[model samples]
Target: MKAFILDHYKKKGPLRFGDMSEPEVGDDDVLVQVHAAGLNLLDSKIRDGEFKPILPYRPPFILGHDMAGTVIRVGSNVRRFKLGDEIYARPRDGRIGTFAQLIAVNEADVALKPSNLSMEEAASIPLVALTAWQVLVEAAALKKGQKILIHAGSGGVGSFAIQLAKHLGATVATTTSTANIELVKSLGADVIIDYKKQDFETLLTGYDVVLNSLDGDTLQKSLNILKPGGKLISISGPPDPDFAREQGLNWFLRQLLRLLSLKIRRKARRHRVTYAFLFMRANGDQLSKIATLIEDGIIRPVMDKIFPFAAVNEALAYIETGRSRGKVVVKMR
Candidate 1:
């Protein structure tokens, strides 16, 4: 199969289009005919070896994780789907190679595509939507009438986070530049803070949860807006120590994570709140729920741009600008 291959990890490395072996399906996996793939910062980070510690991928590996397509073949163990089923998945790291013409994925990680969206739009939702769903709905268990402050409201995760929070009846407060405030507003953000002009930390308080996806400084500042027992969930670096220890990482890794968490925990305690990192897991059940919401017309997919499959690198470069209103996608089929 012809796929975009990553031969090396470099800051500005390019993806070369070439033929790669077709994936062999496992008894628990299904082979999908690629229709479209979503471009995410994770894709770029993995390409450049930025996530070596958390998600290590060796060189000469195919890249990409977010994808939507049809099931060309299904494993005997897969009972939930059949051949020709329209599905999507955010594949596990080291196993993802959605940039290719086909991908074999675990049935547990794949869900039916939302009826309301096209393949391109469905491709855009998995990674970001799952991140938002897990952090707000699963981890935080946000309640109606509660408030959530979502940073970068116009970005991929933020856009979905805002809408989902609102869907759960939470009051959504989001930060975006003046240019994109309208965009965030359309996505159901109740309060919009122009990040350039307003300091959200100073103006907002009593938030039930802070959905953070930015720098360490911003992470620390997010604690201030929460109520006494509120929680702060960060998807970025620096995992919370308590959770890290519970994960039982190696001694060396645990120690390193401990050092990073000390400062975060201190701030959280000082503000009378909880802090934790959210690494979204791929669950077919949860994704199917999200797809149902989309099919009901309660949520919509937002995409900033679409590049042909061969222009995968160009799409990555465009996303690196961090100015996209929504997802950047790659058309594969």
Candidate 2:
């Protein structure tokens, strides 16, 4: 099989495209023929060795997270899907390798692709959509009439999050550049903050939730905009102690994360708000529900570009520029 292999971690490392052994299917796994895969900042961050402490992938591992494909083979214990079933997933951490000709994903982490979407579009939904779902639905339990601020509204997670928040009946505020103001508005953002022209903290107040996908400075600023007892959830994170415990890190690593997030956590407490770092995990059931929303026209995939499989490196470079308005994809077939 042809796949992109990360021989080593480097700040600007490029994946090596070459032949590799076929993936082994487990009892609860499905073997998929890759059609398309989505690109994410997480992919780049992993390549740069940023997640080494928490998600340390040894050298010579396949790279990628999001994928849409057809199930060509099923394992003995798999019953929900069979051969020829079309599916999409953000494979569980440590098992992700979607930038390839094929991958074997655990059945529990796979979902049927939305019938209304193409393979390219479906590929873009899993990671970002799941991130939004986990943050808004699972973690925050955002309610109707709540005011939520979703930062970086033009980016992958932010674009989907704005729509999801609006669908849940929350007043959605988002931050993006002036050029993307209309784009976020189209996604149902009630308030659009042009970060280049205005400071969001000055203009916004008393929010129920603030979803931060930006830098440390922005993360700190977000706390002020939330009302008392509000949730400040960040996906791009200084992972909190809760996240460390959830990942079951060693005591030393847990202490390290505790120390890393102490300042921000204290600030959140002082403001009478709760802070949490969310690292989204794979869930087939959540993806199925998201597919229903997509099929019902309540949410839609926002795409920026689709690159050929051979241009995967170029696609990564393009996303790293921080200019892509929505998800970027690479077509494998």
Candidate with top lDDT is 2
Candidate 2 — which residues are off by over 4 angstroms? none
* Model 1 lDDT per residue over 192-245, tens place: 999899999999998999999999999988988899999999998687665566
Worst 10 residues of 1 by lDDT: 240-249
Error of 1 at 249 (Å): 3.4
Instruction: Compute each candidate's TM-score over C-alphas.
Output: 0.97, 0.99
lDDT tens digits, residue span 1-333, model 2? 999889999987899999999999999999999999999999999999999999988989999999999999999999999999999999999998999999999999999999999999999999999999999999999999999999999999999999999999999999999999999999999998999999999999999999999999999999989899999999988999999999999999999999999999999999999999999999999999999999999999999999999888999999999999999999986
The TM-score, computed over Cα atoms with residue i paired to residue i, of candidate 2 is 0.99
Query: Deviation in angstroms for 273 in model 2?
Result: 0.6
Deviation (Å) of 57 in candidate 2: 1.0
Runs with alpha carbons beyond 4 Å of true place in candidate 1: 242-248
